[model samples]
Target: MNILCVCGNGIGTSVLLKVNVESVAADLGVDVNVTTSDAGSAKGTANMNDLVLTSAELAPELEGT
Candidate 1:
């Protein structure tokens, strides 16, 4: 599974979320390829991922993606 974690800058909170997601997925024995993206660029790549994780404030921008 591919997961994309998004944040304002794509380097701070998103990176943290990526690590956590990876840990949780590992615990569950689920294989996932996780990546991070900023709100500005996420829309373009969001659909490529199986799941897109982002804050509510940024959710609207990724709608339909």
Candidate 2:
């Protein structure tokens, strides 16, 4: 499975969430690839992942992906 964590800056919250998600996935024995992206970068790329995580404000931006 693939996961994409999105945020405005891509260096702080998204990165932290990526680590936490990975840790939890590891504990559950799920091998998944995780990615971190900002709003702009995620536009065309979000559809490639199985899931996307982001704040409510940013969530709409990823709509229809």
Candidate 1's TM-score reads 0.97
Which structure among the candidates has the greatest TM-score?
A: 1
lDDT for position 48 in model 2: 98
What are the per-residue Cα lDDT tens digits for candidate 2 across 14-40? 999999999999999999999999888
Q: On residues 1-65, what C-alpha lDDT tens digit does candidate 1 reach at each position?
A: 99999999999999999999999999999999999999999989999999999999999999988
RMSD to true structure for each model, in Å: 0.5, 0.6
Residue pairs with clashing backbones, model 1: none
**lDDT scores in order:** 0.97, 0.95
Which 10 consecutive positions of candidate 1 have the poorest summed lDDT?
56-65
